[model samples]
Target: MKKYRAVVIDGKKLIRRGIAVMTLAVVAALGVLDIKIAAPKINVMPDSIGQSAVAESVPVIGAVSGTAEKLKSSAIAVVKKVVSFVLTFDPFDLHTAVAEELPLIKAVGYGYLARTANQSIAAYNPQNVDTGGGTAEPATPGTGQYPITEVDSGQGKALGKEKSKILIRNETDFGINIDEMLSSPLKFDMKGEEPKVLIVHTHTTECYSPEGASVYSADKSDRSLNADENMTAVGKAVKRVFEKKGIKVIHDATVHDNPSFNGSYENSRKTVEKYKAKYPGIAVVLDLHRDAFIYDDGSKAKFVTEIDGKKTAQLMLVVGTNGGGLDHPNWRENMKLALKLQNHISKKYPSLMRGVNLRKERFNGHVALGSMIIEVGSSGNTLSEAVRGAELAAAEISDFLNTLK
Candidate 1:
C-alpha cells in the first residue's frame, strides 16, 4: 500500500509538471506569433510649475542579503523589458489570424487572448490597487490596522548628501533661552492616570513616496490621508511605539485638510481641544507632519541617512513662537520641551534627526506646553524612511517622558 501511494504521488507530480510546460509553450507561441501590438512613445520634460523636485540621486547600500535581491530584481526587470518590447510588434492581429489559421490552434489562441484581456482589465483598475510603501495590505476604512511589525533600526553612516542641515532663524516674539532648555533637567509629574500623549496631524493628507517606487496613478496623490498610506500611517507607527513602551497614547487619525487645503489648522485645533477636554492628563501633543521643501531648481531637499545599514529619513523639530500677534505666551515653554527632546534624540540616534527649527507662527502650540510640530521627513523621503523616523522619535520621547517625576 505504501508503494502504491508513492506511485500515485509521482504520477500527480508528473502531470503538474507537464501542465507547467504546456503553459510555458503556449505563452512562447503567443509571443512568437505577435497576435496584436501597440507602439508606446517615451517622453521626458522638466517641470514648468514649481513642484516638489525629487532628489537626483541617493546612496542605496544594502547588506549581504541585498546583493541577492538586487540580482533577482535585475533579472526580473530584464525579462519584463524584453516581453514588453516583443508585445509592441504586430505580426498579425488576433481576429485576422484566427480567421485564416489552423482551426484548433486558432480556437485555443482566441480563448487565451480573451482570458488575458479580462485579467488585464481587472488588474489595471485604479481603485483596486494598493500603492502604499510597504507590503502590508491596506486597511478597510473605519477599521483600525497595525500591519508593520519590525522597525528599520539600522545605523546608517553619513554619506556626503545624506546629512540634513540645521537652519536657525530669528522668528520669535521674545528671546529664546536655548542654553536654559538644554541645561534643564528632564522631569515631569504624571498629570492623571489616563493617557498623557495626544498625537494629531494638521495636514493629515501629507504623504511620502513608496520605497523604491516610481509610478504614480492619476486618481491618487502621493500625499493622501488614507489610513495606511500617508502621515496617518506614520502616526500609527508612533502610537504603537509609545504603547509598547508603556506610554498611553491616543492617535487621532481624522482628516482635517481633506477636499480642500485651507483652514486645516482650524479643524485640527478643534480636534485638539476636544481631546484635551476628554483626556486632561494629556501632557504631550505631537503634531506629526512631513515637509515639502522645493529648491529653486524645483527639486526637493533630501534629508536621508543610513543607520545600521538601513536608509532612514532624518527628523526636524519645528517649535513655533507666538509671533504675528497670535497671542501665544506659552510658546517659550513649548520650545523648551522641543529643545530637550531634540537634544535627547541627537545624543541617542544622531543620524535620525536634522536640526530643530524655530518657526514664527503659532502652529497650535498654545494647546499644551509639550505641543510642537515635528517633520519626520520631507517629500523626498520615502514612506518607509518617514515611518522609521517616527519610531525613533517615539523612542526618544518615551525616554524623556519616563524621566519626569
Candidate 2:
C-alpha cells in the first residue's frame, strides 16, 4: 500500500517451493508412521502435537502412506534384480571373460583347465599303490652273500666254486627244500604258439648307474622315465631271448612306477590281469625290477660278476607266499618254477644267479602258476650290464620253460 515496488511473485518458483514442502511433509509423516508401527503401545509424538493437531494431520498422513508403499515395492523389485544377477553369475565364465583380455591370465587359465581335466581322467582310471603285496626293499650290505647256516655245498658259491646248486635267501618262517623244489616238475603246460610268458615291470622306472660312473649323487633318484634306460629295457632284453628261442612272449612296457611309486604292484597287477584275460594261455608272468641297496655309509651296492669275460650284473628270483595273510594257494607252484629256473640259470652261469629270495608277501604271484619277481641288478650296476644279465638269465629260463608240458 505504501507503493513499495510490487513484489513480483514468480508463480513457477512458488509452485516449486510448494512441491518441495510437500515432499518434506511426506518424509516426516513416513518417519512418524514408522516409529508408531515399531512401538505400537508407546506415545512418541511431541507434546506440542496434541490430539487435535494429530487429528488434523490424519488425511495428509494417509495420502503419503500410499506413496511410501509404492516406494517399498520398487525397492523390493531392485533387490530381487540384484539377487538374480548374482545367483546366475558363474566364476568359471568370469575367468574366461577376464582371460580373454589378459594374456597372462589366458595362459594360466588354459593350464589350469588342462590340469583339472587330467586329474578328472585320473580319478576315473585310478592307479592305486599298495605295498602290502611286497615291494622293492632297500639293499643291505651283504644281500648277495650266503648266510652261514643257509649256504649249502654249492649254494651261494662263486662261479668257480659251484656249478648248479640253488641258493635261497629265505626271509620267511616257511621252510624251502631246494633239492625237492628243483626236482619237482613244473606244473604249467606250455602248448601252442599262444603267449606263454608275460613280462611286466612293477617298478618300471627302476634304473641303474650311468655308464662310466661308479658313484651317483645321493640326492638324485635311481629312477628314469625313459623306457630305454629303465627296467623296460631289461624286459626287452628278456623278450628278445624268448623270441629267439621260438617262445611266444608278451613284453608289456606299461610303466607302473611313474607319477607315483606306491601301489606299483597293484598297478602291475591290473596290467597282468588285462593281458591274462586276453591270453588265457599265458603261463609265466615276470615282474622285472632293479634292486636298490644303500649301505649305512651311503655307498650303493653293485652285484656284478664276470660272465665269459663280460662284466654281468647278477639276477635274483623273488618268490612270494601267503604268510602276509593274503590268499595265494598257487604260491608254492610259483616257488617250484622259480627254483627250477634258478637251478637252470646257475648251471649256465653260476655267478649270474644271486639266489632266490623267498618272502611272505604274495606280490601278485597268485596270478599265475609261474609268477615271480626278477631283479636284474642293483642300482649300482649299469643299464648295459643289467640287459646282459637279463638276456643270459632269460635264455636259460626260456629253454627250461620250453620243455615243460
Candidate 3:
C-alpha cells in the first residue's frame, strides 16, 4: 500500500512540473510576440518539489534545451493563430452582441458605434468616399461657367454719378458720397525715383485652383507657402505691370498667414508699418488677396471673365470703413481710389470687375491715404488667370496713378 501511495505522489509531481514548463513557455512566447496581457497568478508547488521534478525529468542539460525549443515553436504557432483570429473578428458584430446581451446598459450607450458603422460602410463604398481629396463631382469644363451680373454703368448714374460707375456691395451704415470723395484728387507728390506704390499680401499664402484641372480637390487646402504658387505671385504680376508703366512699386512678399491663421492682420500691419517707415513716399498700399466662395453643393465659384481674348479672373476692390469701431479716417479716400480704379477697369472690360465690396472691418486700410484690399480671382481660378487679371487692373491703376500728380 505504501508503494502504491509513492507512485501516486510521483504522478502528481510530474503533472505539476508539466504545468510549470507550459506556463514558462507561454510567458516567453508572449514576450517574443510583444503582446501585452495580464497573466493570472498561479499557485506553484514548493521549490523542493519543483526542483526534484526538474532533476528527475530533465536529467541532461541538452534534453532540457531540446524540450524548451519544441515548446517555444509550439507556443509561437499558438500565438500566431490567436493574433489571426483577433484580426479577423468583426467589431460591429461584437458591439451588437454586447448591446443585445446588456440592454440595461443602454443609458450609457456606445456613441462611437455609429461612427464606426459609418467608417465601415464607407470603406466598402468607394463612390461615396472622396478618397482623392477632391469634390464629389467633377467641375464643369471651361472658365466663366457661372454668369455674373454686369455693372449697369448707366443705372445708378442718375442717382449718384461716380457711385454709379462702380457698384458697391455695402455691408456698413457709413454713407459714402462718391462725388464728394472723387472731387478731391488723389495726389502723390513724387520725389525722383522713389516707390509711389506698395503692393503687399496679408493672406500671403492664399492660392488658386490647379491650372487645367476640371476637378478641384475639396479636401486640399487653398493655401500654400510657396511664393510662386500663392498671392505673392499675383503681387509680382501687378508690380511688373506698374514697373512697365514707369511707376516705382514695392512688393513686400512677407508671409503673414503662416504658422497660425490668427493675428494675420496684426502681423501684416507691422509689415506695412515697417515699410511705411522706411519708404515715406509710398502713397498707395494695396493688400492683395485671393477670394474663396463655396456653393451649398460643395463646388467652388470661379470669378473669371475673358479679356482681350485671354481668360482673366475677375477683380474685387474691398474697402473697409470705421463701422467696426476702429479709427479709420481715410476710408473715404480709399473708397474714392477704389471707385476710380474699378470704373476705369470696367470701361475696358465690362465684366472684369466683380464690383467693390465695402465692409465694416478696417483691414489696415487706415495705414495710408490710399490703402485698400484688392481680391484677385478666387480658389476656383487658376494662377495664370489671376495674374492676367492683376496685370490688366494694374495697367489701368498705373495710368490712374500717373494722373494723380
Candidate 4:
C-alpha cells in the first residue's frame, strides 16, 4: 500500500514526520498550516524587545526537512512577514526585533500599511514586496462571480491618471468562493451527487479575528466577524439547493439569537434541540468562526472583492475537530460528515478556499452524527460576502448531501 506522509513543523522548528491519521489538512495564518497537529518553532535565539511582535509567537524559521525546502522557505517567510509587519518602517530598516538576533534576518523596510502592528487590531499578509518598496511580484488580482470596476481616487489620483478605483468600502476578505474552496481540501468533501445533507451552524460569543487576518474589526460592529449571516445565508442556500432535489431542510438560525456573553453555543443547543424535534432527518451540523492569526493587506487592498465585478464579498471558514464537549459516541460520526464535505470540495473547487481549519476546542459537535459548526468571515469580511459564502455552501453541500449513505 502506498503510504502518506505528514510533516509537522512549529513556526521554524521541525518536529514530527508521519502521515496524519486523516488526510484532512488544517489552515491558519502562519503559512497555511493547521492549528492542532501543528508544531511551533522553538526560538533558540535570544529573546528580546526587538522580536517583540513574535515574543509569544514561535518563529517559523523553516519546514521539517531539506526535501521540503520550498515549503519550508514559504512557511518561514510567511512567519517573518507577520512578525515584522509594522506601520512605521524606516523605509530602509524593517527589522522590528528588539535588540535581538535574526538567524537569517534580511533587510527590513517599509511597506504600505493602513494599520500598524503595535495596535494588535489585525494582522498582515506574509507576502511582502521586493527591494524597491513595491509589492514586487504580480499579485493575482481579485476575481469573482462578478465584474471589476476602476476608481479615480487619492491613490488612484497619485497614480497620475493610472487606472485605479476602489471596490466599495465594505468588502469581504475572501468572497464566498464555494466553487473555488470546494476544489481545495479545506472545504466540505463532496463525492458525487449531493445527498439530502442537513448542516447546522453554531455561533460563538467572542468571535474575533487574529491581528494579521484578511478580515479585522475596522468598526466595533464587526467584532463578532460574520457569524449570524454565515449560518443563515448558507442555511437558506442549502435549503434551496436541497429542496429542489426533494430533500427537507431546517435551520435554527435563531439558535443563539442575540446571545449574551460567550455561551452562544449553549443557547444554540437549545434551538438545535428544537430543530431535532422539527427536522428529525438532520445529519450535518457546523459551527462557524473566523481565525485569530491571519490578517489582510491595506496597500491598495488586494484582498478586497468586487461583486459581478462590482463590490462583493469573500469568506473564510474554520471547523473544529475537537471532541466538542464530553466525549460523545457520535463525535467520530460528526467528523466523518465534516471529512466528507471537505473532501468533496477539495476535489471540485480548489481556489475558493483558504483551507479547512481543524480546531482544538468544541462548540457543540457531539449532538448528532452530521453536526459541525463553521465560521464564515470575520468583521473584516463584508456582509455581502458572508451572505454569498453561506449560499455557496448551501449549493455545494446540497449537492454532496445527496451522496451520503
- Using lDDT, give the best candidate's number: 2
Give the higher-lDDT candidate: 1 or 3. Answer: 3
Estimated TM-score per prediction? 0.57, 0.63, 0.60, 0.43
Q: Is 2 or 4 the stronger prediction by TM-score?
A: 2
lDDT of each: 0.59, 0.67, 0.65, 0.38
Strongest candidate by TM-score = 2
For 332-352, candidate 4 gives per-residue lDDT tens digits of 455445545655543443323
Instruction: Rank candidates by lDDT, best first.
Output: 2, 3, 1, 4
Candidate 1 lDDT over 1-405, as tens digits, reads 010000113565455445545554655654456343222232222352211122122111111123444434443344444433443322234554343222223222434311110112212334432111111111111212212112221222323344332224344446766777778653445445798889998878777665664422222343564677678989999999988987888999998876655456767889999998988778789999886542222233446777788777888777766554455788777878887776677667766766566765567788887888887776557888888878988888887787773
Q: Which ten residues in a row have the lowest lDDT in candidate 4?
A: 129-138
* TM-score (C-alpha, index-matched) for candidate 2: 0.63
lDDT of candidate 2 over 1-405, digit per residue (tens):
011111135675455445545654554454456432221333334454563365345533332333445444444344444433443322225675454333234333443311110111112233322353434343233223211111112234643455545667776789887788777777777887789889998888878787866555644556777878888889888998999998899999988876676567778889999999999999899988887654434456677887799888888888888776667888889999888888777767777788678877777888899898887877778899889989988889889877874
Worst window of 10 by summed lDDT in candidate 3? 112-121
- Measured on C-alpha atoms, candidate 3 has an lDDT of 0.65
For candidate 2, what is the lDDT?
0.67
Q: Positional deviation of 229 in candidate 2, in angstroms? A: 0.3
